[model samples]
Target: MADGQDLMERIGRLRPAVRAAGQPLHRPLLLLWAIAQAVHGRPRQQPWSVVKHELAPLLTQFDGAQRGERDVVYPFWALQRDGLWEVADSAELPLTSGGRRPTFAILEQVNPLAGLPEADYNRLIDDSTVAADALSTLLVRFFGANSGSVVEALRLREFVRGPIGASLLPLVGEQYADRKKIAEAYGGNGVMGITPLADGILAVYSDDKGPYPDHHIPETGWIAYTGDGLSGDQTLTVGNKSMQEYQKQEKALRYWHKPYNGSWTFETWAVVIQCRRRWGRGEDKKQRREYVWVLAPVPSPLRETWPSDVVEALAQDDKSVHDDSVDVIPAEVVAGQESRKLSAQERYQQLSDAARRTDGNRTNRSKPTLVERYMRSAAAREAVIIRSEGRCENPACGGHPLERTDSGQPLLEVDHVNGLARTGQDTPEFMIALCPNCHALKTRGAGRGELQKSLVPVARKLHRAMQRGERRKARPDGT
Candidate 1:
């Protein structure tokens, strides 16, 4: 069995689902927030703004993408695939603007809450072994041989210089403002994270008329990608109709696109879109912005006609490239899935792991696994009582916190109304608080089947009431 230190490294080395060399700075930035959160005395449930403001500087400093601020968008959506964080929203994913992702601004408007898992969140604060291992894993996995400068830039210097940086105190004041540069700049001289595209890449937007290659940019100018594609068109305004009408535009934008005369026979690409609204009446009010994409036919040929700045960036390799082999990613980080029956300890870990993931909603499928359906925790059960206000939800038995425990606490048991043992979900909707007698009648009584059937309406009523109460709080005076 792996020891504590080895497991810590394993957790830190967990990679985000992205392209081989794509730089997803959100992972490291999110990790930093988790660490700093422990250093401070902040709670595990963090609002979107906390991660947003704290992570901005890190994004600006180290994000290798064309626009660093846009980095928050993917983490809000994509980081859910990794098992270390979770979002409060469990609904199906929202629609995208064409194939392009929503910017940071849009995500803030849409998402209400997100955070690290409660167990992991609490552990990183209290456990030095875990924290140190996480730090080491992130450093070695991303920075490899060059973890020192990154440590300084990320404001982990004091911690890094310590015998074991994981024991460093909670950071105070402008935590992300160390202002140190990383060994590599995004898309500039970064040998790792970003894979540089050679000049002369060509992609085409295919119509019945065949591929529409960009022979030259129109007078309006355009944004260039390392691949053969363009950014949102700047010349036109967003949404020609009301804001809702833009949905139709996105569907229209999804026409067939193919690589023109490229080694890869076919290509799959996505379009990014946006809307620019101005104050006006009727049709004059909206302008729809479109960012269409196409794949490149060749890798290193389109140099001459490329934008001057892109050409210049592609040529700025004056500095010696660093060795990426030293980064030391563990083998399991790249392995495909293998399954086995989870032991009781593994069950608890999976529950914690699932809680922290941004995309942790495995039960939304038609036939979710038995384990996936039953991953609940002590906190989750307690939340049911709090949400239920400690009343027996059985309509036939209106039991409150009448019985007192030996500890002088209310005697109530949190029961899975639909029975997780029968493959029911362990979510808030399926849990209810019950007094001892009512609980037995519902779970083990000879008439339990009929009793459970009767309890469904009561459970749903309580769920709806709690939901309404939350909705009111979300909007004061029903505004």
Candidate 2:
């Protein structure tokens, strides 16, 4: 029994060499060394890319060699070409004895590392294997760290360890910055958190922090509030009402409420910030504006770390965990599904059914009917109009408030500032963009005279006030 156990242990020790012998020889020197090693009864030719992929995390510690570089192929190929063992055709290069694959019975004779003391040999194998496994896992997880929130990705980085953990921090940080860049790309009138500072500078907070009804302005272009003690205040206000009136507006907007209250959540705030910056009027240029809203306390609990299982699972499959934490629900409920039991067959069937349903939904039985196409085209037109801020081309009515008419197919209709039918010109300058309400009122000759009289004076007054307001504020650097 003792001899048999010893023999089993010896065979187990030869596994790494056996596995290494089957890899491809890529680099010239390494390939030559591996081939020589194989000829001289040493394991040779493990897949070079596979080994490097496994070692990437640890190899990052070495100078000048990044994880997943082609340079790693040279060393691996050299090992095979050194003639440690004869390479035979197989998934792995098998040990050759008189042109035939050898059995496990000859394990000791074919292994060069096998001559080392058992303890040392085992330790080396264990360390290398651990490093390789860690790197491979990290590379997988690195690609999966695309959370919408920086905090989520940071939490994920903390749960990961060794090479994977190191790789994730920078990758996740880049992702976070990319999200900020995207938000900034939206430019003007983006959703911003405005904290009133006693100083001349406005403390513009990014919408990435949490949900609020206000627009998020970029910190880079914003006037830095130089007022003493202003930096300490991080809170901001939202909406057009006074503080008391805003408070009664319900937690639906403050905390994300589902269904009816889609715009009232943190995610919505992030999206709004992105949208306003990208598509808001005067967003591309610098301007001064005053906004008001009551600052409310954040209701959700702060997460200290990302769930370990989530981080681990996401590293393997990113899309699976994309919306994991976006929902406003208790973490305990989210965790329930992880512990649930389902047989392999049942899980397969469930996934398969989901795929079939998704495919069925995408199938088009007929060309989109004329009405359907019109509705789709109308929706696309509305999106374009919104993106353009519905600015009227007609100088006379450029700033007039516009509205949508059809609830389901709201189309933007412009009325002639100088009546088109009356004026008889095809020029865009004669047309004024009007909201559905204003367009209907103008077309039907209801309140058309009143609206025309009211808008001109209002527009003039607002323009003068904006100009005066812009001049009154002290510019940064006191210039």
lDDT of each: 0.41, 0.28
Number of the top-ranking candidate, with lDDT as the measure: 1
Off by over 4 Å in 2: 1-396, 399-479
What residue runs in model 1 are displaced by over 4 Å at the alpha carbon?
A: 1-13, 16-24, 90-93, 97-106, 158-479
lDDT of 1 by residue, 103-200 (tens): 56656676557776666667776766556656644553344324555666656654443432223122111121111111111011212111111110
* Number of the top TM-score candidate: 1
lDDT for model 1 comes to: 0.41
C-alpha displacement of 52 in model 2, angstroms? 19
